[model samples]
Target chain A: MTTSPPLLPLQLSDVVFEAGGKRLIKDLNCRFEAGPPSVIIGPNGAGKSLFLKLCHGMLAPMQGQVTWNDPDAVSARLNQAMVFQRPVMLRRSVSANIHYPLKLRKVGKAERVRRTEEALALAGLGRLRDHPARVLSFGEQQKLAVARAWALKPQVLFLDEPTASLDPAATHAVEELIRAIHAQGAKIIMTTHDLSQAKRIADEILFLFRGRLLERAPAAQFFEQPQNDLAQAFVKGELLWWKLGKANRKRRD
Target chain B: MDDFGDAIRAALNLLVSLDADLMEIVGLSLYVSLVAIFFACLIGLPLGAAIALFKFPGRKLFAVILNALMGLPPVVVGLIVYLLLSRSGPFGVFGLLYTPTAMIIAQVILVTPIIAALTRQVIEDLWLEYRDQLLSLGANTTTALPTLLWDGRFSLITAVLAGFGRASAEVGAVMIVGGNIDHVTRVMTTAIALEVSKGDLALALGLGIILLSLSVSVNGAVYAIKDAAQRRHA
Candidate 1:
């Protein structure tokens, strides 16, 4: 994989995203600098995926900008890649799927072949090189999706619940790939609902709730001593509203 | 019953003997329709792909107009082309009237809409699935158009074949624009009309059988291509 210049310090300033007459993300101000993998954890409908898309420049914030230092969205996008929750496979062989983005970028034939082979081997999919991507098992397809993105050697990789549908074994494999990608100097920003997965891989944790950033802290500190009520309840595996209700009732009594 | 039997026998004899006149009509039919389809695809595929991929001010209106043109009466198209190519008309200086060129123009007018509209439909559906992934992979709409078109090729083949079927079967447009000129603009559909009018039922039946076979063969080829594409993907 060819090395790409680092695209870091993604800054979101007062970003607001609204759709269908509803505000999905509201006045979010955050800056993510170069670091280990940043895992976003929240309940379903908490806008974790939307936040990732907003930061990746796939969705424009209605009010503010998501700037990745120096380069604009289009130029920065060339050095960034995203893997959606449900990975989409092209109607072609796994090797061809890995080669597509490189071809689009006008990579030379020899370089494309070398990168494809290296990526396939990295993902442990060298044996399935000729297999049609759509025919692969769910786990294998997700792995191929990562391999396809990894071949690009993106500077910033955004993953939105990449293993949401995978079995535990598949999840472990995908997690390992994510770590490998991080080890190779790409900043990994991922979102997941799985608390344990976040605990396992997150260098820093960004906790979101109801489209708001409730807390952002180091993973160890956030897990050991969350600074917010919602984060505390979330860590205890208790429903936010239920915990709030009990606290209110005790205060009334 | 006797007429039917005699017509069948005549048709069989024409087929067995490889009648020169019959061969000429069939050949002209294939030539005109294939040329018409070729031009139609050249104009329509890109038009449809543009319509599917771009967001323009009047895109929906343009799509609706193309959809309505899909059912345009062939005679109406013939009349329009006939006027344009007539000596007093705007394009009369080209002197294409009463020629195979005019017939091809008429067929193109009739078939282009069908191909464009169906291509638009097929490509639009494909773009929906591919838009995000392609865009995420650093492709803009223009870069994505060719990929979408190529991936949706199997279904696009069916659309072009539909246009060919309409071109080959319709006689009203060609008869008017082509003047049914013997040995010049004469084709299967126009020849069938002339033979039936002259009470040459056997010759008409022979042309009819050939036309029917042509339609069936086109349909068969569409299914074969579709099946092959599906199997390769599967």
Candidate 2:
């Protein structure tokens, strides 16, 4: 077995992304090492999803670089995968969907089958393997999407609100799936607005406000005594609005 | 009214008897149209996908031009192909003028733009939803094209059917290029034209009825298959 070089620590420096004539993701700098899950938590329009897109190489950074420890483009690409807020099933059976990225990476047939089975078992989707992926219920489809990404055995997995639309039961199931995936050694980088969910799954927290990373800390430290006032209000369960930035700064002055 | 009744009666009798000339004409028409549609798909699917997926300069204008070509008048297409395949023309050495191949060439030209334009619409819509994911999965435009084409297959089938409809129903291109020769290049549309011009109303109407029915059955069969498959997968 030829083991590829590690793709971490993923480092982004002075990264910016613009769309619709607006700088949606401002100049940002960060580094993610090979470790536990890193959860990016912020309100709407904070550019959390855009940050993930840049990190995953789905969108090019307008100003700076998103670099990985591995320099080879093919290996760096094959070693990362992502799941969206609403999973897009390939209009195929569940098993076929799991096999897709593996096929894209050109995994050997024998290894592909083994990894596919591992993913199905990981998500408890074994019985529904032959069912059409799009025909599955929403939660089941999300599971299939995560499992499909997992089949590549990527070094890093970026999930954009993997449980955003799911019910409590389904959310629990997915949370468990994430932990299981983490246990298997892939770095998890995800974004969510759900506070309790961040508490449940996040090993580290990166907080963004208005397209900028305002604060980042280990999960426990973030929830307990957050460094930034906005983050403090967020941790204290205070309702945050766009106007809150000035109001909070005035109080500080 | 009497002529109409007689024409309907003639159409039924000819259909029931399966006259040798009638069978030959029907077979040739189906052959030429089907072959033209096949070639059109081979060219159109990829061309449409590339136009949808790539961002080359003048791509939007290229798309507009392709859509405009879908409305090309069949007689003009026939005239152009006729010019190209005439003895004095570039491809004249092949001696393909007035043959079934000439008819196919003209019909392919007529149908390709229609298929390609409609396929572009279908694939473009699908690419909107699929682009980010496929790119995240490390698919470049070349790799994403086939995946988008396959995933858009059921929709693309409708595009092909529309092209086939245009190919099988048109008369001007085949009439101009094939010359409507008996037992040589006589397709249903061209034959109906010849019969009408010769004052053989019954045979013309008979061929018309058969042509209309053929169109309906082909469409019905494709829709049935597409519906069942969509239900299973959707």
Candidate 3:
């Protein structure tokens, strides 16, 4: 991985995204700098994934702006990577999947091969490097997806519910990988519905509800003394998705 | 029953003796169809990938047209090529009419749509899955085109095979263009037709057996290789 310039101080201002005549992300404003991992805890349909997509430039917000401190948007994009919840492995061997993005970036063959080997060893996928990536277990596929992103040596890595479908062992493996990535100096912005997972790794926490950022605080402070009522309810596990939906239905009709 | 037994015996004799005439026809048939397939793939793979990757106006219309062309009658294609290469037609100056080249052109016309349509399907499905990922990895549709096509190579092989199958089996197009000329463009299907018409039942049946075996052998060999490669890289 090459030492690229920092793409930090990422800011989103009044970022509004609508779909099918409904607003998925409201006018949301936030700023993230080079720091510890920031875990976004939210209920389903709270636009956590969409938010990540906007930040990664996978999507364009209908309004407002998602801007990096770097003026060159193209280079900024090249320096950030995202991993989705359901990993889509290319129809090739495991090592090839890691090699794909580097190839896309036109990384030289020697560097590409060296990084691919390093990623394989780091993910403990050295043995299955020749095996078809699509044939791997779901957990392993996610790991490969992460390793593939990490090989890019991005300054920022956004993961949207990457371990949502994994078992406990897989979840633990993914957490360890996230911590390792953070240690490598990439700011990690991830979303999780699992509160326990949030507690395990979040240095800072942001509570999202109904497309709005209701609260943002350091992890310990956010958990122990939530400033917002909804955040308090969410941290306490008192606000189930159905209860939120029932309240929404009452307000709608 | 006696005639059928004689035909079988004659066929075996032709095979064992390595009949020069039989080999010539077989060689011509393989040459024309394989060349046609080569051209078909050259035109079809990229056309299909474009249709799958880009969102231009008339895309759906083009998809429908390509799909409809897949079922086009070989005779109609032959007639079209025949007129195009006829003395009074635009391409007549090239004098391609009734030549092996004319036959190859007709087969290419007949096979391109099949390859393109199948390639479109394979590439479209892959694009749906890889669209976001590829875009994030700093690729636009243009750069992603080759990647999608390469990833879908295993399935694309089936498309090429389907084109080869169509070309090898169809007699109507080649017959019209090649004119079944002895030692010129005489291929397996046309020879069978000519032999059967001339009441040479043994030679006709022999040709038929060879053609059938040839089709089966090519398909069997391709399927074996395709299956093994797909499994290894699946």
Candidate 4:
């Protein structure tokens, strides 16, 4: 029961999200097949994190539906996990933190021990097995969070700004863990403002601007020649205000 | 002042010699309060956790009511229980009035709200931190309650101890309900009250010392548990 049912080919159709009477995600339609990580790149307030949360079932779209293999949200969620920007560590030992999800799933005692040890080894936290998770350094806590999620062996893993606040070394470590998790056959849907990080890990890029899905392209194609103006500005590190003004003009026209 | 010194000396002597009457009162106090707290926790912990974690109409009002009940006067509680257990009342068939059971019922009524209110505050704060994570892990509110309670066990210990403290120290409730029946319903608080009124300062002072020691010990146990949890999780 540790592994979830097939959660591949996650689809979002006509997804509309509004908060505080403002649209945050507008008519989002996308199909994410099982494959290399799909990196979402957008500027601040572009609803990147919200989109991730919506797709991960943390937030329900005000209209439309998000389905995984046509299953209900709860069934879909059983096989998925999300890592946040600042992951919360339970007030327990590192091993206990990793063991929690397995216990929740009612995995047997033997399997829990095995998966816990495996996850700790994968995250290189074996030495800190008995240490309290809260006392870990920020980087180590993030790693532990990933390991805890990884132990569940989710089919689709959503990361919202997983490395947003980490130093270079810590960022590299977390990125490597993300890659490792992906290599283990989980669909990685990650949101990052860092274009270079997106470039390095994304098999495909989903570009968003002002709550709209602007473009979805192969990683190489997106980096070489972005089709949308906002994508181009984002790729070239230009201010998005100019592109926003152009979009406003186009809308008005 | 000389009389106070004599009382202290007698208190110490009574404690050292393990006086039977004093011991009986101490034992009865512990039994009644512990039984009350056991029942209180059984009702309060889950009630508090549910109130904190769930949403429904009038939840705010329910929470306000529980918080207000935390300050309910013990004598008022005693009065209410007395009415219920008296021979003419609805539950009078059980003949529970002026008995140890009546004393326990009064204490339970007095302590349950304290445990529930404090547990709600502690568990509510924890739920804020844990709600998203637990829900994301496929746990609904019901499944997550025990996890939240277990993780917050150290603070919950303090809540239970608080209930015990309230139950043990209160004289009005047990006195009204138990009638301070000699060798039967007599407990430390009621005994102290009786001895003090009868001008028997020696027994009163002795019982007072035992009650104070019990309070100190309960608090010490709470602090010890808290420190251990901190060290384990810090």
Candidate 5:
């Protein structure tokens, strides 16, 4: 008999994070259903990235607990990996770098070779396997970072602006990889400053504004009709996000 | 001055001839320093990494201690070690006085802190860049330590080379503890001192050239490794 997976793979209850006498994330409660992927979108300083980190257990909430439905079923630490905007590449061969996490997990030699090749192939880095990871172009390096995480087959993947620094072509490549990874059954949770990217990859969007998760809705609905004023003005580029949106409009014209 | 020129010619001739005494001293210096560096790395590397990675009480105090130890006077260390291994001292039972083993002990003590302190700096620098990525990947402190070390391998090699250079060239500590016994405890640095004091400029000059060459080679190796690393990283 086959066992069915739980409906909600991730849950955060009244999560709060404060740093340096400032409330960064205040009392956030959210649940991620094990269906379509989730996206987190916000203006600069919206705490969107911080919230993604909290959900991935990278940052501990000051006043809440994050519970996984099957905490015992999988290693929480091992079941998720995040790709940061600026990736860290070890001073090693590309293949060796890609195989790093697998080596740490002590996967067998043959299996590591097989999976490393698979990851490189998926990331379009098959030819440069022998090249040093650091020597790869920035776009290639970012791809390597995603491939590195993808190699682990993490059940829940957290991506903090994986495409923020990429050009359009590189952004497309990364988005495609994200989609392929999501297709493999791992839930994708990402944060982005680019609304277009949010529109492209997000099935659902969590709109964060000034440390508050103001609204959560489907991706199409979030852009079509942001429930909160901050989010609404943000979608239309009418609010000041960087300079409080007023300056953003001035710069826009 | 003529003697000095004669010594240089003689030393070059000896090196060309592969002089047995010089070879033995060179071989011994390499072996003892190597063993000392190995032990230092095995112990000091982890210690430094811990000092950098963890936030225990007195950590700043420990850092101060290591920094002080890095500049520790070798002669004082030698005297302390000499006294400890003397007949009336507690470790006299081992009969280690004036032996190569005593020299090794002194060298290890002198070099370990250097290795530890330098490695700590390297690892600490890397911690800024990598700690988050590794943690996000779910690597605990235990797992991250090794990964950090491996990633920072180039820097660690320079640390080890620095330790080796210090251990090999140090005369004061190894001399007092080793007693400069010919054919046994007599290494390059101590032999140079004895030969120079006895007005035997040829031998002293020869050994000096060897020591300088050794230093050059070690430094060259460090640079070559660094360059290779940069090329790979590029």
Candidate 6:
């Protein structure tokens, strides 16, 4: 197995966010080491997705900076890609949809075609390249979304509930695609309501509640013993966990 | 009444015979409407996209003006264009009044705001729908504005086609500005009106039929595009 080069992927300094006269994320700080995949597990409205957006540079931090780093220096990089829960497909064919960002970045014809094919292969979507992305089953579209991001060869990948709407078989397919992406050397940070998914895919987990980070720990430890009461309640299904554990327990046992 | 029927037959005969004057009128009307619609799109699309995305201090006022202009009476638009191009008006030094140029000006003014306001509405809906995703993508404000507009191209195409349909069918403004000069400025609508007023029913009816067919074709194309976009989006 190839190991990724050691590098710090992200650092979040005292970040604050206030919207609609309410504080969504209050004075939070975090640092993820260079090589391990991290998962953000939280209840709905807990700002897990929001924090991902902040890290991806989608939203301006009200108080602090989320910086990407390499051993040489800590600076922001443009080579990061993100996938939303509901994939936004262009009103175009599947091939054209995958070709969009590559076209934007001006990847040459031969290179684009090759990269796209490799991405499709990685996502197990080789046969559906010509199919209209919008017409694909939701699971297939989400896989295509991952394929689209993988084609970018991003340094860090942020997924905001990438499988929230999938069935079991489909969810497994997507999770596998994510693993494939991580194997290819992209550092992965994902937000999910599913603790089992976190346990399955995440090396580390960050737990959040009501727009705040309650705890961050290894995935095995987070599931085995969450540090905070809210995290405990969330894992046990007392909190509105968006049915994450319910699906996991039914499928796993 | 019988005379009117006879005139209709006569006009049909003239059309089948390829009457030069009737063909000239058709050509002139198409030329003018196409130019006006093109200019309307050039000005309207960007303005509409901008107004839909930005929130400046005077945004409400600008939106109100555009919305009000969408309903501005055709004759009022004609009168305004006429005054501006007339000998006594400010730009009268160019002496463009009662010309096809003046007619184009009138049509462009009459239709640009209608297209802009409608396009604005379409793009605004798209902005609301995609703003969060776009922001999450790290898109800046100016980039998001055009990106949202591009995402909603299906509806924007419809807006442009609507502008063309309106410009082609509108008569009050063009007639006043062009003076409907025979073989020169007389287009389908103005010619239809002139021929009818002169008891030349054949020419008027023939022009009306052609006008309806043209409108139908424009609308047909718009519908085809919408259907294709819908299928792909689905």
Best by DockQ: 2
Q: Pick the candidate with the highest TM-score.
A: 2
Instruction: Decide which is better by TM-score, 2 or 6.
Output: 2
Docking class of 1: medium
iRMS of each prediction = 1.3, 1.0, 1.4, 1.3, 1.4, 2.8
The candidate that wins on lDDT is 2
Winner of 2 and 5 under TM-score: 2
Q: What is the per-residue lDDT of model 2 for residues A66-96, given as tens digits with 9 covering 90 to 100?
A: 9999998788988999999987899888998
lDDT of 5 by residue, B108-157 (tens): 89999999999889989999999888877656678888888887887888
Q: What C-alpha lDDT, on a 0 to 100 scale, does residue A190 get in candidate 2?
A: 99
Ranked by DockQ, the better of candidates 3 and 5 is 5
Give residue B78's error in model 1 in angstroms: 1.9
DockQ of each: 0.57, 0.75, 0.69, 0.61, 0.72, 0.40
Model 2 Cα displacement at B225 (Å)? 0.7
Candidate 3 lDDT over A67-142, as tens digits, reads 9988788789999999999878888899999998899899999999999999888888999999999889999999
Estimated TM-score per prediction?
A: 0.92, 0.96, 0.92, 0.91, 0.91, 0.85
Worst 10 residues of 5 chain A by lDDT: A239-248
Tens digit of lDDT per residue, candidate 3, span B1-234?
776787888889989999998888899999999999999999999999999999999999999999999999988998989998999989999999888999999999999999999999999998999899888777899999999998899899999999999999989999998899999989999998898899998878877888988989998999899899888766
For residues B106-184, write the lDDT of model 2, one tens digit per residue.
9999999999999999999999999888877777888989999989989999999999999999999999999999999
DockQ of 6: 0.40
RMSD of 1: 2.8
Docking class of 3: medium
Candidates in descending DockQ order: 2, 5, 3, 4, 1, 6
